[model samples]
Target: MFCNKMLELQRVYRQASLLALITIYYNLLEGAVSVWFGAGDETISLFGFGIDSFVEVISGVGIWHMVRRLGRGETADRDPFERQALRITGGAFYLLTAGLIATASASLFQGHQPQTTRWGIVISLISIVSMQALIHFKTKVGTALNSPAILADAACTRTCLRLSVVLLAASLGFQLTGIGSLDAVGSLIIAVLSFWEGREAFEKARGLGCGCSCGCTTSTKSDH
Candidate 1:
């Protein structure tokens, strides 16, 4: 019986580590595109897009830490450290979200509309779509594997996908209306959504000690 548990623990740790590596790699690519096109177009949405990718880097690190602490043998018996990391990431997400919204809103208020770049548009479109597919995959894999890290990774991906709607809207709005302010408004909306989702994750992580992803197998005090 103990052997089986240890084997499952090993599998979960490996999967979480894989997830972390993938996310970080994608984030780096995202950051590069955002920087290359953002300044040229002077678009807040595009620039903030980069920041959003970088933000996920922190979340990925948290998951990595969780995987490491939950590693082999004796350490496996210790409580999952990922929950505390999730709480911290959740709070940071909210704070960063507020900043994203404020900056976008302020830009809109100031009537700062930016020109769009073709590369930026293409990347954003591809990113949003690709992430949607990944989100679906994560959902399935996490459910099947029943790993908190997998679940948390999916949740983060979903959050980004949701925010992409606002981003796309702002991008198109600016393109059509010749007003950059729409971009800012879009950013503000993203911030609100981020805060709401982040807080939800925070509460779930704290109270349940789970990533709020489906199919959790962890035991609680009441369960014992």
Candidate 2:
């Protein structure tokens, strides 16, 4: 049983590492594409895709921090304060999501169609799948490990999965209905969802002793 558990941890760690590396590379590629297609084409979807890539990059960085903490045998020693900080960061990430959605909506209203390059839809699909996998793994780790940072990471991936739904809508609406407004409306919906997630993250962080003295400087058990 002990061996099995150890193997599971090793597997999870490997998966996390793969995700971190890929997300960073993906962000660079996406940002370049978005910038190149910024004008005279998809002013919103392309730009929004770039923004989403950055968000993933942030998540990758956060995960890297947590991974190092785990390596140093410090995860177990993390305090409530650190946990609250993670929550705050999570809240900020979602708030940025709201801003991205707003920008996407505004662009759509201005009738901006993404140039539909070879990479846009394909990469988006791959990202959607990757995020879903991350969400599942992170949520499980957070619950078992009692790690707020892990939980927040899971939540961000969940948000990404939800936003991908809107992207799918944009694809379909463009192909079927030919109504550009559908894409705009989808962006609005995603923005509203982002706001809700942001508020949720803030509340969760507060519950973990944010803006209060909970003496979060010490942990007896392992955070991993």
Candidate 3:
């Protein structure tokens, strides 16, 4: 029975690692396209959103590394490595928040109106669908694996979904109403949320004495 359980865990960890890699690839493509169009069209919101995608790619990599350790039969609560990974993910989120804020503020100050680009709208719609599906699968796998890092990774994807909605709204609004400031405003909102998420991750890391992702203080807690 013990051997069966270990095999099951190994299988799930492999799946989680594959999902993380897929996320990295998707975000890389998405970020490249977004940055290209965003820069060409001078859309601050779109550019900031692209930058966020790249940051998410880093977070995915961190999670993938941690899960791979588990796949190698390493203990999940290994303090040195797990804590380092958590801190890396947390710091990346904070950096993303700062970048978004700075970009949005500069755009607002300059009164730079984002030119309507149909590509922004299309990309955001695709992101919404893709992120939602990822959220579902990540949630399932994270729960089965009982991994806090993986679950936190899923939460990040949820934030990406929200950002996509904001991007779509800003893009469509600019296209229809010709309002330039709305794009900056959307980016500002995303910045605030990113900061909040970063803070939450940091707090979780600090509270994790056992280095498990879920923050259970005792062995009685489910490590599933």
Per-model TM-score versus the true fold: 0.73, 0.62, 0.81
Error of 1 at 70 (Å): 5.6
- The C-alpha lDDT values of all candidates are 0.64, 0.55, 0.74
RMSD of each: 4.7, 6.3, 3.8
TM-score, candidate 1, is 0.73
Candidate 1 regions exceeding 4 Å error are 1-16, 67-84, 117-120, 204-224
Model 2 residue runs over 4 Å out of place are 1-15, 38-40, 76-120, 132-152, 200-224
Q: Residue 77 of model 3: what lDDT?
A: 49
Model 3 poorest ten-residue lDDT run: 212-221
lDDT of 1 by residue, 1-224 (tens): 99897687677566656766776788778877776687688777777777767666666666566545544322322244556655766777677687787777678677776777444467668888878877776666566555544565676677677666667777777777777677777667766766765665566565654443222334322110
lDDT tens digits, residues 73-152, model 3?
66564345545655766687789788888888888898889767577799999999999998888879888987665676
Candidate 3: stretches off by over 4 Å? 1-8, 78-82, 146-149, 204-222
- In the range 34-143, model 2's lDDT, one tens digit per residue, is 54663335535445655555554544554555555664446433345544554655665576677767676576667755454334355457668877776677667656
TM-score of 2: 0.62
- Candidate 1 yields a Cα-based lDDT of 0.64
Better by TM-score, candidate 3 or 1? 3
